[model samples]
Target: MAEQGKAAEGRIRIGIGGWTFPPWRGRFYPAGLAQAKELAYAAGQLTAIEINGTYYGSQKPESFQRWHDETPDGFVFTLKGPRFTTNRRVLAEAGPSIERFVTGGITRLGAKLGPINWQFMPTKSFEPEDFAAFLSLLPRDCDGITLRHAVEVRHPSFACPEFVALARRHGVAVITAGDSPYPQIADPTAPFAYLRIMGTTEMAGGYDAAAIARWAARARDLAEGRVPEDLACAGVPQPPGPPRDVFLFVIGGFKEANPAAARALIAACA
Candidate 1:
């Protein structure tokens, strides 16, 4: 009952990119904690963790099942789609790779499967026809579970109306990444929101109270189906809709401090 109530106010999940950070071993995890218990420990601290390992390679069903058993209920994992699918030069040829990833042991996680983040190289720019063909390959349902997709296009060329319209037409969220060398486009192109905050410094507690408060407001705005105008890279008009779910990940920069940053944002959301 308590968990349901908390989820009802807004399904804003705050987390870091991955859990297997060496820096977190002593700072976040207790001293002498078993290395294998990292995910469980981290899941207890944050609402979700982006599965970055999968971006590099695939995992077995047992691995996914174990991850499902480790996390608490309502916890989710925003998986990075395999680079084999998103890193290809000819985007149209990525169909088989996409199928392999989608049909991989991912569905073994069941409801714990959150969003599949299809991150492209910073050099990859928008090619309407090619991009649309790739988006078409994304499965609406993997096995029997519904799937959610988010595209993390790093190039500045993606910050355009045409790109936003294409993503919206396909109901795929255009990732609103935080401080980066690439464009941090913050357009809500889908029913859900995905953010990768890469600006955390080594400041005390990762982010000061003020910064977390501001981010909390932004997460709240996204959950309410509104865009935070100040943070948006493109000036697209807000799409009309009811409130939506949100996934916020603290990643990059002072990577060691990401866990603290995630906890701070989660507290601010409370």
Candidate 2:
């Protein structure tokens, strides 16, 4: 990892998957808050968000710009790479589709755009050559701005040294999926780290205070480039690398408890 401007203070951001959950209207969100104000409100609470809608379809430039304008400075939105490409049968032939998605209006988000997550299905087993070809299609920059990439491979076959080497070669982060049915990877291959917390309680707040504290410690370790021994990672053990920025998100454990989970994580980290 290269030196970053925010590394000194530990650039760790905690957030939820998305902000438009109707269940949160009266639970996590204010009772009378307008639906349109949800993004703005959520942005004020969390440091970053994972944009899942983009995986379904392309969004307009205007929508991207509006999201940027609504958020506070330094807030970021990590987009899900369109399923059209990832779900295709031949992963190697997804270049054009990848181009269209990359050159789309996503650049309108400018500095607010974070990592692009290319999530593979649980059945998508590790195919070194094919997966490497797909990774080759990812652009380090969109237009003139730099972009980061992460791959969320669910199949257990991905938990191998070869997969780790491929990702490290491409400088793409392998998502650290916390408590999921999917394989958890803590390689920290990219310049930064991206995490998805899949297990949260159905309680009012997503996680209990103890869990929140544990996650906070994990976040601190990530920012400081210290990978915990407990987490699973592919390949042989390696020494701790330099500190880098970290982006953490709570992805659908208890849907309504997401906001509270994010807030609690943020407070614990602070």
Candidate 3:
């Protein structure tokens, strides 16, 4: 494992995926990014975060600067590429938009950023070949920032060995979620695994018992790998080496027990 940063580098790291409570925009987030930092501070025990709201558009400089200033050092942040970067838009339509959004987000995130997720919208006919081509088209230099990249394939056509091969080939981490179809394609060898466990139906309705156990186990394995470093590649040598500190995010649980669930998972993970 790499020499760790400040926060405790567990075998695996954990946090709530996000808090998209609609109320934030009107009250907590009158501006946007600055408010998110404050919200992050309030999440209690979270050491890292993955921001989804930014997927809608690029953030303003002032907003991002607030993020840079407010977050405790060693806070890892993962952000999904904006809609313009990954929607069903034609290549012609997507090209420019991708450039703009990626450039903006990278600049905004700067050093705080970790992974950039490209979550595909599931469609019946989205085959592997076409998807492979799409993956190829992504600019290696997104916003001049070469952060860890990941992709989540929701279409049923993506659940196959070939797709996983393509992901590894492109250095794109295949996201592991509690969602249907996508979960079927989980890759254990990914550089950093991410779990978006939630209550959504697309995630098989609610959390499954076995799925939670899988998450707990993964947390243990990854935390063991961290060894107290922010980035986990210091002396990691080669394949089948210790797992990097993955993010096992509880995106959902019973609404009432959300906090309790996070704590329980954290304890089990410890």
Each prediction's TM-score versus the true structure: 0.95, 0.96, 0.71
Q: Compute the lDDT of residue 30 as modeled in candidate 2.
A: 91
As a TM-score, model 3 comes out at 0.71
Greater-TM-score candidate between 1 and 3: 1
Candidate 2 lDDT (Cα, 0 to 1): 0.87
Candidate 3: C-alpha RMSD to true structure equals 7.4
lDDT (CA) per prediction = 0.86, 0.87, 0.57
Candidate 2 off by > 4 Å? 1-9
Model 1, 20: alpha-carbon shift in Å? 0.8
Deviating ranges (above 4 Å) for candidate 3: 1-11, 20-37, 89-93, 140-145, 179-182, 199-214, 222-242, 253-259
lDDT of 3 by residue, 156-229 (tens): 66656666676767777766656333444445445666656564222331344555555566565554452222
Ten contiguous residues with the weakest lDDT in model 3: 227-236
Rank all candidate structures by their TM-score, best first, as comma-separated numbers: 2, 1, 3
Write the residue-wise lDDT of candidate 2 on 1-270 in tens digits: 121124354588888887888888889789999999999988887889999999999988889999999998889899999999899778999999889988889998998899999988889999888999999988889789898999999999999999998999999999999978888889878889999997887888878998888888888887887887678888767788888788999997887888898888888877
Give the per-residue lDDT of model 1 (tens digit) for 190-225: 889899888889986888888888888988888877
Clashing pairs in 2: none
